[model samples]
Target: MDGGVFANLMHGFSVALQPSVLAYAFAGCVIGTLVGMLPGLGPLAGISLLLPATFGLNPIIAIVLLAGVYYGAMYGGSTTSILMRIPGEAASVMTCIDGYAMTQRGRAGPALAIAAIGSFVAGTLSVVALMFLAPTLASFALRFGPPEYTGLLLMGLFVLAYMSGGSMLKTLAMAAVGLLLGMIGIDAMSGYTRFSYDVIELADGIGIVPVAVGLFGLSEILLTAGQPTPPAIQRPTLRQLIPSLEEIKLSVGPISRGSLIGFLIGIIPGSAHIISSFVSYGIERRMSTHPERFGKGAIEGVAGPESANNSAATGAFVPMLALGIPTGPITAVMLAAIMVHGISPGPMLITQQPDLFWGFVASMYVGNVVLLILNLPLVGLFVYLLRIPYSYLYPAILCFCILGVYSVSNSVVDVWIMLGMGAFGYVLRKTGFEPAPIALGLILSPMLELSVRQSLAMSGGSYGIFFERPIAITMFAAAGVLILLGLKPLLFKRKDWREKVGLEDQV
Candidate 1:
């Protein structure tokens, strides 16, 4: 409503609505769907490989394309998950639970249809939330000082720890490692480089794109190399792809609730689509009258978690745009991309850089439409992607990742760093640890230090600063309770027991 802000926004829409940007948006969606339809290659890797190409593009055009890729992958991932039982990314893993089951039972069409619809509904709903809520949220966040940020960071770390895979001690160690990795760049206050290792390549610090792609993409290829290739998918026809009206009616409530839950969790740092999907699945199962139907190809199972995952992907954009915080690893890559183009995502970004923000927002609407068109009619095309031999697919993914790493500032050193991280990621995978927390820590490192130091300075080096602020105190307390609950064997053990009981009954 402010004159300057309104004017800037109008300019942003002008750029976003341009015919050329729309074409790039469509191209990004198409590429995303293709990569997402494949099992090993994911958006992070795809974007990493493409980042070098975008270097020559206008910042707005580049981001519009990348954002489209991001969400289109979300849509495409569900396709492979439902039809082939292989998740395109970590978040889509939950979709495999019921989706693959539906495929086995010859319900692949309805399953894919439901997922596509749920993703569209959730993505649109979250975008609407972003349109109206981002400025408001940024205004509210302006009140935050050092104590609040510290509290928020602490909460982020704990949430990641709780949500990470088995072995709390190992997860803690991984997180510490991530926090230390985050300390690699220069110390903000003193202007001292803490862990540069006398290397010039590190002076600008490690790029999140190479690190993320290495961890998630390369490690995935290595992991899949040892496992048996997934079973082939039986293609579904157009008639099979369309869900009945009754199925749509049944899914509406879950899709709506999932959008809300996914969006809220996504705004918090360290929360990712995986966490949202799992939580959404649990909630949907509990609320369903026939909870037993969940693992038995329940329509709600396919709808709720897919919607939540996609919505969470959309919601993760909010904090990145408003608070200058990268909520997850993928967005961390996007943040790095923005900064690499000499732009920062922060509070002033909205007013000073409304063209970038609103252009990106408008492009999302166009991207959603593009995704539906590319994903739906071409559902068969995407399914065909699953038919590619693992031998060929894995190598292509590796080659792309290698090229992506080598392309970063044309530094061979980054390639070495990427390989090192890939090996480390493989180890973590073998040990049942999720790479996401490491990615979270790597991205949050600089922010964490800034907050910690600022809070200390504000409190004259007193540690009690974190406890003094009400919002900070509340979030930390909630984090503490969740940590205790996570460590305790009660809820998860009970839930596992119940699931076992349910499985036995079916047997």
Candidate 2:
């Protein structure tokens, strides 16, 4: 690292290690872990809820706490995915396929350990990359016009659909539905409502929390409720929690590859963690010598996706800190937190507010270590949660889901929306439709629409603007390639796409 950058980082460490800052970081980590462990609650909700509390604090302290929550939640989400079939966050969904499979096969200890270890390594590495890359990348992103953003968002969605392990047609269809739903609120350019039905709540469009909670959390509950008793868990002893030499050897390559993939994707706008995890899982599956064992119980499956998710979380900070752009919902909240503290995050933030920028970066390194220490010993505790009877557990989960949705905006309308989505999700899943693509579509649709409208306005309604820009052309070409590759299965129909792609089989 440059001497100046190294000096700034050392100063940041000095600031972060203060008693008050350390206390806030520790508190944030604990609260974030608890929030992430619960279904329906994620970094978005956790940061939003605590945002009010940080109003009285200094910017650095507040950011330290909030940043801790952001990455800490990533760590906690893996525990739920591995112990139960539930993913605590959207990014953890890929982990569930092989993580729970490993649990069922009495390797839960190794899986959990690998996830924690891999997350630590990836998180730290991403922070290092973020420190060096953010300024350079931010400068490059200054050239991005609306046309470029439009292409980037479109490419991201296409890539997600292509990587999603199911029928590409079905995934694209779900994305279409999501786009329609995302259009329900008022149009930014026209200032006219599209699908609000004159309801005040609908004016802001649907809350992602409701949709995510309903589709993944409540639908899983309803599906599991209809099943037979869960299998008895094989609890591993303390010694077994540590991975064997051979298992570590198998995981190292995946961990390294996943970290790189995740950091690169995370710098893009939207929820890159979900895409990163899915992409990592796909890459690991393809690269494995025993590809057939992937969905069954592959250690690389658990390690790669988990590492990617955490690394992606760290990478998200680059845009928010360096460019004042919120990559996803969680960072959007963090942006709000910074603004509330009378600080605007942008290109000048590092120069004008060096302490806040570097201190936040330093806190990440501390938070990652804290999470590793916190999560390792608690692996057994989380696994023990799976022992509770479904009859008792499902009801509690239902209550928590309801509470979480309501808490988002204190709107009963949100709760109703969640329930409606839950029912829709259950039916959709029964029909072999995955909810993930719809969620992604919902999240990206508004941004895509706005970008398109802006691009057209800049081009005086001309269609040639997208192709004229080099970055836009590159992104569009990438999107086209992904779309064609995704459609290859439909064109050929040579095998069951689900089996060919290692999609999760219905339990």
Candidate 3:
């Protein structure tokens, strides 16, 4: 609400209004839609492949393009999930529950329309939230000591363990593995090589780009190759794409609730987007007057989760832009790109780098408009992409995955590591394990280590220092409660049942 903030933000609109930048934003959204429509591609993969191309752009322009692709892909992912029952990304999985069900029941058009509207609603609201809340949030983040951050990180990891939609033991195991992988580099403080395994390649540790692309993209290629060919999906008509007033009415409340849930979840350091979508879906069903209609093509079921995931994606940016801390792999790459350009993101970024901050924020609004324009007319086009043969798609997907990985350092060694990771990723997926928690752990591990080291330095190595701070103590207690509550299977099982019953009532 400060005059300066408003003025700077207005200045940002001036920059974002450029014809060239708007074109780039449009291009990014188009590319993102193509990638998101593909079963084996996700936002991370799409962004990685495009990173090198953005080097010539101004920081704001570059980030705007990247952000456009990020949000655009999220919109496109739902099309595939709804039409083909093949999610373009992990976050789109929740959409499949109701979206594909609607498809089978001949309501694919309505489902897609609702998702698009919901995303637009949620995205606009989240950006509005960012505009009002970001400065305040950044100011509060400035108050966090290393101990507080460390405590928060632990709390985040625990949230990931339960929120990941897998067995508690399995999620924990993945987190442990991810944390160890994260440690495989030169120690920042002692300058000691902890897990380099006598290999110089790991001296700088595994780059997140290669790791993410390998684990999600290449691995998905291998999995797709192994699966039987699926039937071709047909595109729905534009007329079918528009939702009824009653349907829109039914979805409004859920979308609003979803955005709220997603925004809150995304502020924490984890894969909150994916988890928040499912959580939103669950809530929508529970809150519905007729819960039993949920799995049978309920409009609320698709609207809430779709809106939630996109909103959460937007929310994830707040931490990265305001705190200089990457909360996930996508944002981690964005942070790296910013740093590579010799600009560090932090609390003072808004005041110190007004153009960079405001342009980025304003461009989000532009990106949303671009996404809505691209998605509304092109829903059928994206659905048509679902018909591309997997055999043909996998090769391109893998090649781009490799190209994306290699572009990070121009290292073939990274490609080799990526292949190995692909194998590992495939195995894990085959074994019913989720890769999101691992990715989350990878991003958070360094933060956790740095926080611990700084906290130790602050408290002169006192072990009790983490608990002494009121904020830290509160976070720790919240984490404990989350863990305990998450473990009560009977409780969640009952909750799930109640949600189902609630959905039935809405019908």
Top lDDT hit: 3
Residue pairs clashing in model 2 are none
Cα lDDT of candidate 3 equals 0.82
- Give the candidate number with the greatest TM-score: 3
**Which tens-of-lDDT digit does each residue in 1-507 have in candidate 2?**
235778989988998899999999988987777667765566765675676678789989998998888888889888888877677777888889899998888788899899999999999999999989886766687788889878877876776566556677887898899888899888888899888888999998887767767776788777777466556655566677898888899999989998998998888765678878977887888788899888788999999999999999988888788777666666766776788778977766877787888888888889988999878886566556557776776787788778767876788998898888889999999999978767767767877898899999999999799999999999999999987777676788665434554554522
How does each model score on lDDT?
0.80, 0.80, 0.82
Q: Residue by residue across 1-507, what tens digits does model 3's lDDT show?
A: 346767867988987888988888888889888888787789999999888877777777788888888888889888888888888887888888889889898888899988988998998899888877777778888889888888878887887776665576788788888888899889888899988888788898888888888888888888777588776685777888888899999998989998999998887777777878878887887677787787788888899989998899889888888888777889988887777788978887766777777888888888888788777777766666667788788888888898888887888878988888888999999999877778778777887899998899888989799889998999989899977766676555644232333422321
Ranking by TM-score: 3, 1, 2
- Candidate 2: list runs displaced more than 4 Å: 1-3, 35-67, 80-108, 226-238, 268-271, 290-298, 319-356, 381-388, 492-507
Report how far off residue 290 is in candidate 2 (Å). 4.3
RMSD to the true structure for each prediction, in A, is 3.1, 3.8, 2.8
The TM-score between candidate 1 and the true structure equals 0.92
Selected candidate, larger TM-score, 1 vs 2: 1
